[model samples]
Each structure stands twice: as C-alpha cells, then as structure tokens.
Target: MHRLQPLANGLRTDHPVPGIPFVDDSHIPIDDPAAIEAVICREGGASMGRWERMNEAQGAWLAYTADPLRPELAWAVRHHPEHGRTVLLLLTKDAPLWHSSWRGPKLLFRQGGYWWDGTTWYRPDQAWDATCKHFSLRPVPDATTITAADILDENARTDGGRLLDVYRFDPEAKPPDSWNEHLAMWASQRAADARPLSQCVVRLSAPELPADQLIGVPKMPNIGDIVAPTLRTYIARIQRELPAGDG
Candidate 1:
C-alpha cells in the first residue's frame, strides 16, 4: 500500500506479505520470548502479531496476525527457537477462493497448500516452467474464524511428504495426476505425433475460478537489493511508527 512508502515495495521489511499491505521487521529473540526485543505493531501500518514460543524447552516460536481491516486472510510464521528457518504461511477464510483451487497440495508439510492462476488450479511444481520467476501459492486454508488458533494449526501438521508439485515429462505414463501428469498423458496419447515438451500447454482441470471474488494480493514491486542501509531504514521506520510502550 502506498500508505506505507518503501514498505509497500518490499525493500523496507524483512517479511513482506505478498498481497497485503502488512510487513514485519520486528526483531524477536529466538532464545527467549521474554527477552528484551523490538516489536513493531503500528496501528495503520506493519504488524508482526503477538508472539510466544509454541512449546516449552525451547521449541518453535510463532507470530500471528489477524488484521481486522482484512478479515479474509491471516499471516503466520513458524521457526525453531534456535537454528531453525522461518516458514511463512498465508491462511485464508475465503471458502470460494480455497475451494476453487486444487486441494491436498503440499508445501513444507503434508497435505497442505493450493495453487491457482486466473482460470485454473495447477499444482505447484508443474505450475511453472524453468522460466518462472514468481508463481502463485496459497499455503493454508479451512479456517472458519481466524485467530491465534490459525498459527497453532500450522505446526500441528505432519512434516512428511513435502510435495509442492512434481515435474513429469514421461511419455508412457498412466492417467494424469496433476498438470505435469496431464502433459505427459497428452503426449503419450499422441505418441510419435506429439510436439516437443517445451511447446505443450496443459489443458488445466477443475476449472472453478474466475477468482474475481478472491482477496487481492497486490503484486510485489521490486525494490532492488535489501542491503544494510535499507534494513536500517526498515528498523528505524518500525521504531518510528509504533507507539512506544509505558515504562
């Protein structure tokens, strides 16, 4: 959102929610939630959400935000208390948007995620070619009402079968499973007459969306490299924006 200046450009925040105006650059401590830290939750701007360790004995830390201004979606992050990479999740309460896309798509977890274009629901891997720089993804859904519980839901899934999507160029394959499978199945049907794999376009299935009713994820504008100076500016903005707490 232009309301927030450089933050609207992803050049200003460490975590930028792609479609929404929210961005979080808060420096939450990994070792202890109670430790002195900088938390930025501006009323009209960026928010990191209320955070705490998900489990005791130094387990995963979580940050969750349920923006009242935008009720259709929620944002969360899960990372080990120490030495763990953060995983960002964008959760939605929009049934029409979620149901229109292919279900059971996996991201870093089993049985989660969705992929969609303007018209069709495509699996993640087969959704793009080697040429894709940015692709569409919906990480979690099925929340009737989003709250702190949504972040808890993300950590509850099995960490197995991490299938975002698969590539299938095989010609003699069985019936189609996904976009990749559909392509191969089409090629196998043609046998010798089929065009080269590079030239083929998937017919796309479960066509359930014009997606006009879905939440608008504003396309990200490239703000160039996030160097030290920009980051310092980011932190300063957070400090400058959020109202200081009572001592």
Candidate 2:
C-alpha cells in the first residue's frame, strides 16, 4: 500500500522508482534561466554530474543530466505565471511521455517512468491535455553521448550498507530480504489505480543491487498494448542519439 505524501508548498514526493530514492524537490525559483539552472544543479548535488541544456521554449528549458544513465533522460521546468510556480517536467527524449501512451511502470528502455504534474502523478499514457492536441517531441541537440561511469557511483547502492569480503568476488551478495521487500513496496505505483512497478529488474546505477553484481540488461520488448507502444520507439530514439556504432 504505497501513496504519494504531499509536501507543504503544493508539491509532493517522487515515487521510489526503482534504482532511485525517495528524492525531494526544490521550489522553482525566480523566472530567470540562471535561477532555474542553479536550483536543478544544487538539488542534483554530487550524485548527479553536469547537465546539458537541450532546448528551451514555451518558458520551459529542457536539460539532460550528463551522468552516464542516458542522453534521453532530462528534466524540464516551465514557469506558469498564473500558478506562480514552475512545472518540473521529467521527460524522455521522445514526446512528453504522457503522449507516448506507454502506461506501465518505469523500465530501463522507457524511462519516462512516472511524473508528478504538481497536482497528480501521471503514468506515461495517463496524461491528456485538451488545450494542446499534439504534444511534439523535443529536439535533441548534438552533444557527447553520456553513459554510466566506469567507476562505481559514490552513492549508487540502495542495498543496506554492508561491508564485503574483498578477498573473494561474490556477485550475488545477498542483502536482507526485508530490505529488498521494503524498497520493492515503495517502488510500485502508489495511487489506488496505479499498480506496483514490477516487471523489470533494477538496472540503471544498479537500483536494487550493488555495483559489483552482474545482471544483464533488460531486453527491449517488441510488443506492448495499444495505449502502450513497444520500446521500439525508445530504442530508435537512442540509436538516433548515438553515432553509428556508439549506441
């Protein structure tokens, strides 16, 4: 039984999407670009690296985290004067994920995962805007392709902190089952209509497991439901993003 706990200033906590934490948010500052940049940068802290600004329009600036996770992953913030708050948008490289129609839990391929539109948490396919008919995809600028770092992340592990025996290599060094189950519970969909974030193993940054572990990447499924298009578009975008054999 998971739920999104609301914060004081009309904001809420992010779902513990696998591999990520129950990360908090900072308020949208003054309308200046520098202000927005400073907030995102400060919030990201040491866990995240430099961010690459992709595009800005409609008072929203889209920037991708230079961290090795992927190029398609980025955060967009738009200031709505009426609301007096800027909307923090977590968008994939494709169309605003809500428009992608892939309404499932977060996956390694379709990482739109889940988003909170200041009021409601929306699945990839759950969002609809009467005002804007076609939500066009953002243009990805030419930049160096980002990937996970070769060295282990300073704070990558979600597994309860346990010192390992350096003498031997054990890939499946098990953590307490309750620990896994506890995070597993939070990882799923929180709302009554939303289901748990099951189906895929924690992949990026070794979400559920330790970095020393060796688990293969989740396969990009070729078929999905009508409202849920397959990861073909996801992979296609990645291919477009990377040079010839880079992806």
Candidate 3:
C-alpha cells in the first residue's frame, strides 16, 4: 500500500486517492493539448510554401513537454473560447485545497492578495465586498480538525524552494474515500463564489490595494540588511562539504 511520507515542514506528501489507476507512459493522452500543438505545428510546416512557411514557423514553434511518469499525477485540460487557447493543468490527489466562505455580510481580509479556494486562485478586489464574506474553507464541514498537504500539483506548484507552512486539519481521522469526488463538488461552489472582473478594472491588482496585492513586487531591503539568513545557512552547509582550508 502507498503511504504518505511526512515532510519536515509538517505537510504530507500528496498521495493519490486509493484505487485510481496510474496512467501508463504508452497511454499519455495522445489527444491532449501538448500533443495536438505538436501535430498542428508539424503539419503547418509541411503544408505551407517555403517562403510563407518561414513566417508562420516563428509563431508555430511554441513548445511543451510532458511531466515524467508518476502515479500521483492528476490533470485537467481547459479550453478558453475567448482566448482560443487550450490549457493543461495538473492537480494533486487528496490534497488540502484552499477555499473561502462567507461569514455574514462583511468581506474579511481585504489586504490579502491571493485567496486559494481549493479550485482556483481568486482576486478579492474583483469582488464586491457586500456580496462576499470571510475567506475560509470548510474542508470538512462540522469536523473539528482537517489535514493539509504541500500542493505540488501542476496548477498549484511552487518553485520558490520554500514550501508553505502546513495547514493542519484533523490528522487523526482518515479522509472520506471519495475525497476526489468531494473536490469535484467544491469546484462549482468556487465558481459561484467568484465575482467577474469589473468593467473598469482591467488589471487584477491596483495601487489602491495593499502593497502585497501587486504581483511581482520586489522586496526593497533596508541599507542595514545583510545576506538573507537562508543564504547564510547554505554557506555553512557548503563549508562543511569542502576541505577545511578551501572553505
């Protein structure tokens, strides 16, 4: 039996929902977006006249790669009619997804930039305050505790080398066997909770909002600041690995 391994940060490894068959390498969704893109691009090269092909080739060279075979992989493909594009998404199984709920009439945490609602990331600024309430997920309604995991799935993977703090749920109890099913049910709720972007608000985050609201805002360190503590720890590790004098 496959068991979840605990990480140092307290999040458990994302384990697949029991009994879901692992997709074999030979059956890696040939009709998927990546394969389709490759086929279309290759055919376009063959069909076009030499001179015309050169111009088209520039745009057609968009490349995509598949993830290595893993039993834990779960994915979804989405098509955006407005953008005329297909998006491939990977998701984790039995992971503690973030979601928000209303608590009375007030919108809580206005300063929070991004709120994860287990399904998709939501920008609260796009929402009308009166229409929403506090941002909280009822992971297991009525349950005293819940389990949380590091969401390293495709749609919600992290690259900062820093895993988020483990959000503890009821760790003692086993989740419902149909946990994935529960996630699907939550999807529609999240959609209903979402507010369309205002006509005047083309940008998701604005200066009127908190500083953290602005994605990609660089941290401006004080003049007195030194190297980050994490970097110092890495230096110590390197010294230990090197010859005494060389370090």
Candidate 4:
C-alpha cells in the first residue's frame, strides 16, 4: 500500500475553504502568474461550469493524494473534452507512472505554448495573462514571443551550464519536442547500455507569472473517504523518500 505524506511547500497551493460559497477568501491568490495561468488554462477558466465540475472531481483526487493516511501509488489527472470534465486515474505499480524516464508519471493535458493559440495544449511560452475577472485567453505569438533559444540563453545566463547540454538538443531541429524525444531516448539507451546513471538537467519553457499564481490555491479535502486504503499506503512509501526540510 502507498503511504500518504503531508503536502510540502513545493506542492501546496492556495484553494477555497470547503462548505463555503462565494466567500471572499474563496478566491485564493496564486503566487506565480505563469503557473496560475497554466492551472487555470488547464482547468479551462473558472467561469466554465465544466471547469468547476472537473475541479471538484480532481480536487477530491488531490485530497486523496495529500492524505497522510490514505495514499496512492500513482494518480493521473485525465481530461475528457467529450464530457467537458476531468477524472483521476489511480493505478498501482502494475502500471507505473511513465514507461519513459524523462516524462513524469502523471499527465495533465491542457492549453500550452507549443501549438498555435486557441489550440488545446500549449507550450509554456504560449500561455499568457489577460485582464479578466476569473479568466484569460491564450495570447498569439508576436515579436515579443519568447523563443526556445531565448529560454536557453536565459538559463545559460542564470546557470553556468549551457542550455544545450542541459536540454540535450540539437540547434537545427525544428519542433523542439523532437529534441526532447531524442534526449529521452538517449537516457533510455544509456540505462539499457549499463552506463552509470548521471543526473542531467533538462530546460523547459514555462509561462511567466507571479509566485503565488504559479503555486495553486490551497485547501484540504477528505481523502480517506474517497480513495482505496492500499493506494494510500503506496503514497506513504514514496513520501518517505523525499528530502526532509521545510519544502
């Protein structure tokens, strides 16, 4: 059984208080604007009834993952456009998070930057904030659009390592995911080749937003009532491996 752990600073986000309707504090502040935009866009705007419903479903699952008692081995946030809703997929080790090492175990698909504006799924650069009460639109790329090269350069400036090395990409490749795939494949190859595994950082494009906005809203849900007991145990095992500190 997976064991559950308390949410660390890195994973905690602001959320509404339960059983409260239309309270002022219900609208929690997200520290990182870009991150908030990612979450909001992923949620398809707060005004959408579908988004609210999806949030309710996913929020319950997250609460389960956050439980200190009940735990999950791996949980996925599944988006279903047909129903205009999202669901959580809880799996045991029989189904690992990802077959590949480079990818995270779970997937949350929504608007992102890589595609043209208005398309589902966006790359981080494509996400933007518009002046709206509880919603925003994806911005079209313009002269000011942050390019992959620009992202690489910024990382190089901030960190001593070259972005190319960090991201493991070829400059000539179009549609950067090809490079991302190459890096992933190479890691898999190395693992198979019996080479000592070395830590390699990968540079990813992310949206620009405030700290609170990036971190999400905070709230605690009753997970014990929702998820299976064995899954809860699995989460606890993983939580024990995490670094101990404030985060």
Best by lDDT: 1
Candidate no. 2 TM-score: 0.24
Question: Predicted candidate 1: what Cα RMSD to the true structure?
Answer: 21.1
Question: Stretches of candidate 4 above 4 Å error?
Answer: 1-74, 81-132, 142-247
What TM-score do all the candidates reach, one by one? 0.22, 0.24, 0.21, 0.19
Q: Write the per-residue lDDT of candidate 4 for residues 130-244, one digit (tens) a residue.
A: 6543223344343122222332322233222112221222212221222333233223323242322221211122444222332111111122232322332443355322111
lDDT of each: 0.27, 0.26, 0.22, 0.22
Candidate maximizing TM-score:
2
Candidate 1, residue 208: how far the Cα is off, in Å: 28
lDDT of 3 by residue, 79-159 (tens): 221211111112223111100121111111111233222223244333334546633432222211111122122243222
Q: After superposition on all CA atoms, what RMSD does each candidate show versus the true structure? A: 21.1, 16.5, 22.4, 19.9
How many residue pairs collide in each prediction?
1, 4, 7, 43
lDDT by residue (tens digit), candidate 1, 34-68 = 33112334567554345554442245454444333
Ranking by TM-score: 2, 1, 3, 4
Q: Which is the winner by TM-score between candidate 1 and candidate 2? A: 2
lDDT of 2 by residue, 193-224 (tens): 33223322222232332335432112112122
